[model samples]
Target: MLRRNPIDFFNLIWSDEAVQKISKNTDLITRSKIEQNQENLKPHSRLRKWSSPSKADIRRLMGIVISMGVIRLPSITDYWSSNNVLCIPFFREVISRDKFWNLHVADPLPDNVSYPSKSYKIQWLLDHVNMRSQELYEMGQNIAVDETMVKFKGRIGFRQYNPKKPTKWGMKLFTLADSNTSYMWQQNLYVGADGRETELSKCAQHVLDLVEPLSNLSHTVYADRYFWTLGLAQRLIDSGFNINGTVMPNRKGFPQRLKSAKHMKPGEIIAFRKDDILMLQWKDNRVVTMITNNCRSDEWCTIKPKNPNHDTRNKPKCIADYNKHMNGVDVNDQLCTYYL
Candidate 1:
């Protein structure tokens, strides 16, 4: 994909099928908007003209969109300003600011849109990108499932707010990404209340949705405490996959001894096993409870802290592996933050 030409690279995500449909929808939306504006026009009002964008126009618009992330100013209008310091010549060369904003929509018509759906507006386009992504590359041996937010401060349903996230206010998503390259294999948008009968929490159910499709591939899927559970570990083990993740000490089925094990000093380790699943309580800054089907709780590896002041210590291999492979989504998020 890196070796592909610019046009070829664009086609991989925005295929001919997507481009054609979007072009028609863009024309329809622009026409409808212009008609509505004409109805309320005053003596000084000027109706915006409408023309269906060609395939080349669509490609150029997307290129400008990508470039906007790399180069930005205080206002959208600034990019097209006659003032030499604020103007970006490439933006005007491709399309005018008014035209770009007018053609920004590709949503389904009202009659065809599904009612009571949170993701319907952009789902069709997302489906195309996801299908193309899978076709383009194979994932790595290790996978990490986690959440990331897209920065959107708008009046839209299903917007999320997580104060802990770097992007605290935006679209919340559950993503399964390759640990090595941080390539997103699949993702599901977080819609409030899926309205399905289930024993798992909404977060756990999302992990199942993203990872279930990858079963029988012998992938080691890693997650954090908020998403993993003993039930999840058992399910993945049965499906020929492995799961290793930190767990909340107070979660159900946790050993009674581990709940109050805060007294345990740092580097102390205790574990309990039921068949193939091992539940470990390891003390670091805090006593962390973990459930796993593929890690060796008994094995230990040497650890050297990055800070020169901290002393070297022995750490569980499971913790070592988890630390190494669990940040794929975070790395992806960091890259996104830079662009945003």
Candidate 2:
């Protein structure tokens, strides 16, 4: 018998009860704001009465936001006023500016019976998205872990600023994605670095959390220098996973001997292996250090330079593979940028 597709077999994990709770909170906040404004109204001023939004209204508001990205309008009101989107019908009936502006997801509550103290304003939505993203698909053999910043410069405590990112000011999201298809299998918000966990351990934990479903499946994981470490490589190898990534010289457990500079020719590789883990430092124009769990550190490949005049360079097999697979998250980020 033919098996069902794993993606199709999974159902929406976001619960209706959760949606109801959020919608109720949104309505409560919106109505309370209107009431407060009415109380502060002048004696002869007319007060505008408004009703709370329902679940359907909230969905419509979200749809408008999605459409705004596609429309690329200057502002929300531009959809109606601008000549570009004028040809499109039913612009105003679906969502009004007032409804979109006043849209709320959660009410401010401090450690109540209904609201957990640790929970964030958008925690419910975040949890649902994470659950659904993971449930919908099974990860491929090759995967990667990286950070993606969502653009939000508003006042939020968890907001992070990374000068290197295209979106320098936003919330940080750590994602695990398939290298082959750039499919996001799992993701989590980077809610400030925890003091309890070391930077190396935090990176490893994020990787493990993303690949938890594929733990014993003999998969190969690729990451950049930020998350790769000798201890993580050993731990992953012990858990029946192969890992390969670039490493910095200063990382804990990195061999001091390998750090020494030796005048060497291109393709010259110095490898150190302890059990299943392998660390290799290959010389090109400069030394490129890498660590792997399952790759043969001795293996080398011919690499042609981008400039045709430059001579071809020799790169380690692990480095070549890392170069190819490490762009999964980057490619996803580009796609998102293009869409935006």
Candidate 3:
């Protein structure tokens, strides 16, 4: 008697195990009233003659196909062209490339097998990715949230300008990155400009939701100025998160300096009152007046004179002129200090 190959015998045994597992784990077979269907089928009908593949056979074939595809298909086409004879039926039935590859070579099973939907598979993968990220972050990690844009040619629907790359047309893609490992935590696609209030809020919410699982372990969430808002700040503060960012300018009013009752002592620092006197000397002229917040004083110390005129009596001057000639003058030109 010809000795059967050990590999082939092992495959046969594995296929039997797979089929049994599927039947035992699922209600697809038990819930279906096959007896009624059998009764309905005509005696001569092809359907009445059909027999389901054994559970072991299904599992073995699935494993073989998956192993072969993964190891063999990297060079060219992902399909099993060499094993077309064995895989054609499975390729036609299995919607997932992974399932098709796995089931094609493991065992010779029927082609009518049904599997989960593509959407279901995609959601499962996404959930797995999120879970893995959470595990890593929980071990103490820093997360950074940043936005990007993805562009596609052709007018599929609404078109918008991308702020990051203004010339390109695409929707914003927000991503969370681990500061320590530089691993991407999660990414979200949005159909709007990055700077839009709606888009910014969505990005923030997405980051917050993704990191929610690892919130306790996350050290910090780094974001740009676009995410800096009073409401966003308050929300983070309420959540017991310390925010590190550039302080936004005060929009309400300028800070007030109180008047002191006593005269200024030498080397003593005093809040310069608005009524402090300053002699404004500009080219052959002198105007003495009280310094108000209207005239910025910071510029005087840093302002460079246009030209050192030996005849100090003849210089072209005005408060604005002196400020304009100075480099590094405060852009807002706010009065900085009182000159005695």
- Best-fitting candidate, scored by lDDT: 1
Q: Could you arrange the candidates by lDDT from highest to lowest? A: 1, 2, 3
Q: Would you list the clashing residue pairs of candidate 1?
A: none
TM-score of 3: 0.34
Task: Identify the runs in model 2 with alpha carbons over 4 angstroms from their true place.
Answer: 1-22, 35-38, 41-48, 80-90, 107-119, 195-200, 262-264, 302-313
- The better-scoring model by lDDT among 1 and 2 is 1
Cα lDDT tens digits, model 3, 1-340, are 8888866754433444444544343323322433447667567654343344456545544554555544444432344344654444443343334332222222222236553322231233344555555454432233555555445455533345665563367544556665444555565555433343452355456656544554443244555434544445445545544333321222112122212213333322222322322112221132211112223334333334558763222222224432232211121111211100
lDDT of 2 by residue, 142-169 (tens): 9888999989877877888899888999
Leading candidate by TM-score: 1
lDDT (0-100) at residue 177 of candidate 1?
A: 92
lDDT of 1 by residue, 125-149 (tens): 7777777888887888899999989
- What would you estimate as the lDDT of candidate 3? 0.40
Residue-pair clashes per prediction, in order, are 0, 0, 20
